[model samples]
Target: SAAKKTRTMTTQSSLKDAFSSYADDLNHLNDKREKVVKASRDITANSKKVIFQVHRISKSNKEEVLEKAHKDLAAVVDQYVARLVKELRGSDFWKLRRAYSPGIQEYVEAATLCRFCKSGTLLNLEEMNASLSSLSDPSHKPLQINILDYILGLADLTGELMRLAIGRISDGELEYAQKICTFVREIHRELTLLVPRMDEPYDMKTKMETMLQSVMKIENACFGVHVRKSEYNPLLGSGDPSYPLMGVAGGIDL
Candidate 1:
């Protein structure tokens, strides 16, 4: 009976030790997740600043505005996104994707916006990931922004472009607004085909609805500009799309 009691106590002791280690492991995981969340918040905040900076682009300051935007975006990558990369390196980022996904999406939005503004072209996902390759060590798998996040960010970009289109139309840059309208329309059409295949189709479905609204906004702005231009010169049949609007009835309202 004495030997049996000793063995029972030893088994109980082992169980306690095992449970204690489990608790420690859980606590460590929670701490790491919290750190990644905090880093994500920083990345999101700085990426937004870059977006706002890009919005400062104008017909005259294209080069200067894009130069500053590029610099600001690079700062976001080096300062805030680097922290996220460090925390997620070697680990399966998919596991913590929910925590960092918002920031990644925002970063994609800012970077793509800057790229599009600099050159009227879409920044492909592979190219975006390639840009980040320099930030990672060769030994560990680099943290790549997954397709879902990239698509979500692209969806958000249309809204900004819509705003830019309205402003460009108001500024008498009807041709620029039309260009933006065409670009956004193409993006929405392509995204419609791709969204169905994305991992989280439900979330992307919501974005696609919002993207449709953005597409309409740009289309409306361009349409309004053409209508106004036509009205101003009844005989010219829409007149010169690129002609400065200041010549059209003291600048038409968008």
Candidate 2:
């Protein structure tokens, strides 16, 4: 009887130890995820600031607006993005993507906006990640932005581009407005084909709807410009004579 009791106690003790260890591990993981969530919030807030800064750019003060935006973006990477990079590990990058994605997307919006304003080119995802690479430790695999985040960010960028196009048109920069129309139209068309291939089609679908609206807004703005230009051409006969109707043609196709 005593030998049987000793074996029973030993089994109970082993189970207790195992459960305690499991509980501790779960607690640790929960804490880690909480840190990631908080970091994500920080990144989201700071990244929005960067986006706002970039939106301040105008044709006249391009250099000054971008300079300020660049500084704000750098600060965001240093302060908030770095925290995200530190907390996230290999699988955690994808696992916690939803938590951090808004921030990352906002960052992408800002970076690409600045690039477009400065050079009339999209900032590729590779370049955005390359810029982020320095924030992570060299020994650890750098935190690279995945394609999904990049794509989502790009979707949001169309909205900003729409705003920029409207502003440019009001500023009498018709050519710039046309360029934005062309760029947003291309993005909308490409995303229409790409959305179904994405992992979760719902969010992309919603964004695609919004993106279509952005495209329309730019198109309408450009169309208005073209119409005004055409109507005034004969009356004034003094403005630039080479205004092309290419932008209106693209809008009609949409």
Candidate 3:
């Protein structure tokens, strides 16, 4: 009876030890997830700053605006995005995708915006991920921006394009405004088909509404330009400093 009791106590003790070890591991994982979340917030904030910097681009200071935006984007990748890569594992990438997706989407928006302004072409996801590969450790797999984030980011880009279009019209660059209109329209049309098929459709569905609004805003701006072109041509011809056309360029409600 004494030996049996001792064995039972030993088994209980072993179970306690196992439970303690598992608890410690769970705590460690929770800590890591928290760190990744914090890093993701940092990345989201910095990525937004980069987007705002890109919005500062104008026909007059395209080079200066893009240069500053590029620097800001690089800083976001180095400081905030690098932290995400360090804390996240291969499995964690998809599992924590929602936690970090906003930041990644914003990063994609800034990157493609800069590329479009510079090269007049879309920056493919492969190229964007390749740029981030250097930030990760050699032993680990690089964190690649997934297709959903990329598409979601592209959807947001239309809003910025609308703003750019209105600004371009105000700046008397009507053709540039039209080009923006066309680009945003195409993006909206394509996304309409793709959003329904996404794995998680809620976010994309929300963004689709905003994307459609952006498309309409650009279209309205272009329409306003066309409607008033005859009246504005004379003022432009006379080199009016007041630029009365600016008053007619309505703001997008978005």
Candidate 4:
């Protein structure tokens, strides 16, 4: 009887120790997640500012707007995203992905928009993570933006591109508007094939639908510009229309 009682005491002590370790781990995880969330919010806010800055681009101030946007985007990488990298170092990326995913997606959107506006090309996921590679420790696995987040961010880009196309149309830049239309259409077509295979198919599906709308908006704007040009052609015989974007404001909600 005494041996059995001794065994019971030992088992109770071991159980207590195990649960204490569990509690400590839970607390640490919670604290790290909170810190990561704060950093993510900062990243989202600043990335949005960069997007807005890019939206200020015009034919006359294209260089100036892109220059300022590049600086702001770099600051986001240096400040907020660097903090996120620090928090995630030596940790399982999949474990905390949900905590930081939205911010990363927005950063991708902002960064890609800047690159596209400057060069008329899509910024790939490899180039994006390569930029962040400098912030990571050489000894540790770097925090790379997964293809899922990259694609999701790109899905959101169509909305902004729609807005930009509408604005360009309003500025009498029909050629630029058509360019955006073609780009958005290509993005939509590519995304349609990938949506079903993505990890978060439902979310991607929603974004795909929204992306379709954005594509149509761009196409519609381009069509309207073409129609306006045709109607004005006979009256002005190969000359530019005085108001190419007339009534564009009323038709476009973006």
Which model scores highest in TM-score?
A: 4
Residues 157-201, model 4: lDDT tens digits: 999999999988777677777788899899999989998899979
lDDT per residue as tens, model 3, 150-182:
998898888777887888787766777777787
**Cα RMSDs of all predictions?**
3.0, 5.4, 5.3, 4.1
Worst 10 residues of 3 by lDDT: 245-254
Cα lDDT listed for each candidate:
0.84, 0.83, 0.81, 0.89
- Predicted structure 3, TM vs. truth: 0.85
lDDT of 3 at 92: 63
lDDT of 4 at 100: 95
In candidate 2, stretches whose alpha carbon ends up further than 4 angstroms from where it belongs are 1-4, 89-91, 238-254
Q: Is candidate 1 or candidate 2 better by TM-score?
A: 1
Q: After aligning candidate 1 to the native by TM-score, how far in Å is the CA of 166 from where it should be?
A: 1.0
Can you give the TM-score per candidate against the true fold? Answer: 0.90, 0.89, 0.85, 0.93
> What would the per-residue lDDT of candidate 2 be over residues 83-172, giving only the tens digit for each residue?
888888544577677777777887788788878887888899898888889987787888898998889999999999999888887666
Ranking by TM-score: 4, 1, 2, 3
Candidate 4 lDDT score relative to the true structure: 0.89
Supply the TM-score for candidate 1. Answer: 0.90
Write the residue-wise lDDT of candidate 1 on 56-115 in tens digits.
877777799889989989998888888899888767788999999999999999888888
